[model samples]
Target: MALDIYPAIDLKEGRAVRLFKGDMQSATIYGEALEFAKMFEDMGAKWLHIVDLDGAFAGIPQNLKCIEEILRTTHLQIQIGGGIRDEERIKLYVDMGVSRIILGSIATKNWEFVKTMARSYPVAVGIDARNGKVATQGWAKESDMYSGALAEKFVGSAVQAIICTDINRDGALSGINISFTQDIASRSGIYTIASGGFASSGELKILDENPYISGVIIGKAFYEGKINLKEAFALFEK
Candidate 1:
């Protein structure tokens, strides 16, 4: 199967940034968010993964204007998450031309609501895990629920995908937690996208060989020039 690539553009205070281990204080601004969206589009990316970092921490959509600008300007299919806690906000993003909306913190608190939304829209559950435990409220609060256990809840639902991130490896550029990601994929029985700590084409090849992993979110590695977006995309082309 051809592995899908989602070039990421995490927004912080209206600027594109990368955070270390989901730390708000460790944000390294890349540039204007819109520019990064365009750059990803130029690199032959079919999808763009965007996160409202400010919104994730605030529990409210804070970077509406920035998000709107990218939606209006870029043609890449967008999947966005962060601070989307209500049906109204979900509707708002859908109306704004977003292809999909990811529910992070809310998935841990009210997965039933997530299942309901999945019936009507393209919804993906963002399971950001730290040490096998699920973390919510922007990775600040660790829940007692195990990551695989949470994923098992949506075993047979309308939910489109499970975006599982290993908090410890995120933004560190060490390596991707393939075993952890595969575990989620096995439990959820849903399309799973791996996020965090993707540093090279080697990792991409590893994911391509796994049938359960549908895609990956490229963050710090892409920003730090550790991976070439075009070259990574070319791997599955052969």
Candidate 2:
């Protein structure tokens, strides 16, 4: 399968930023959210992965204006997560033209809600794992449920995809956790997108060879210049 590349624009305080190990204090502001979305579109990105940092922490959508601007101005298909705990919020995003809605903390707490949403709208389960366990509340809290076990619950569901992130490597540029991602894909029996710590073409090559991984989220690597998006796209396109 062709690997889809989703250039990530994590929004903190209505600005594009990258957080270290999911830490809010470690946010390194890049620039305006619209500018980043435009840049990714110009670079041939088909999809954009957005996370509302403030929303995730506040349990409410805080960056609606910024998010709406990006959606209106850019043609990039957006799959957004953060602060989406209820159906009303999901409807709000969907009405705004968001292609996919990602349920993170809520997915860990309510599998039935996720399944119900997936049946009606495009939904992706955001499984942020720390130390092989599921992390929630914007990674501020860890749950006893194993990541794979959580993923397994979605098996045979209507979920559009599973976005699995390794909290330890996210924004740290340590590297993509291949085995961990593959395990989620296998357990979920759904298309899985590997997120966090994507830093090189070598890692992309590795993911390209993995049949289970259907996509990846590129964040810090793109912002820090660890990997060239154009070159990575070329490699994948070839």
Candidate 3:
């Protein structure tokens, strides 16, 4: 049950912005994407979670400029999500040396596309939900699908992991939705990455014991100076 914490570098309008509940309009740019990524790397984080905010909302590929900058700069294992809907987009990221390509919107909408991607790439499935119902189209829309039901779709494939994010808790700095996250992992045997509403290391300490939980992605807490990545790494090192 080793826990891996991925400091998030979410790019919105080519700058780093941690959005509340995945809201794009209510965001504040904090720094350049490359500099931010470097800071996370400096903290001894071996993996980076990078998201293209615009690409996620527009349903089109954006932020390749910043992504390329990250690829050129860091040797860390990079897992990229957002606007990755088709085979070409998946190929583009893999060709650029992205370690894992996350399929979100397309995985919920097009079964054939998801199947094709699992067959062709090192892909991951992201289930972003609000109150247990899945959301898509950049978290602007919700669906009737439960997170567990969705995980059943990737039973056997190249789907390396499932990133389950509680949309209501994202960027809120309230608390990690542990019960919901743990429930999904318990029911589904796939490796799970917890996302959204992680406000402190104490919350992570609780999660560290869960063998089903493979990783957690930190965004607002990391930006707000709540969770110290360096200390987190040190704690895990011990």
How well does each candidate superpose onto the true structure, as a TM-score? Answer: 0.97, 0.98, 0.95
Q: Pick the candidate with the highest lDDT.
A: 2
- Model 3, 1-238: lDDT tens digits are 3698888988886788888888888896888989988888888888899888889888877899888988899888899998888788899999999999889988788756786777778888888999888899889988888777787777765678889999999999888788778777776577889999999888887889877788899998988899888989877753
- Write the number of the candidate with greater lDDT, choosing between 1 and 2: 2
Q: Could you tell me the TM-score of candidate 2?
A: 0.98
Alpha-carbon shift of residue 103 in model 2 (angstroms): 0.2
Cα lDDT computed for each candidate against the true fold:
0.90, 0.92, 0.85
Clashes of each: 0, 0, 0
- The regions of model 2 sitting more than 4 angstroms off are none
- Tens digits of lDDT, candidate 2, 104-218: 9999999998999999999999999999999999999999999999999999999999999999999999888999999999999999999989987668878988998999999
Better of 2 and 3 by TM-score: 2
Candidate 1, 26-53: lDDT as tens digits: 9999999899888887878878999988
- Model 1: how far is 105 from its true place, Å? 0.7
Candidate 3 clashing pairs?
none
Give the residue spans of candidate 1 off by over 4 A.
Answer: none
lDDT of 1: 0.90
Give the 10-residue window scoring lowest on summed lDDT in candidate 1: 229-238
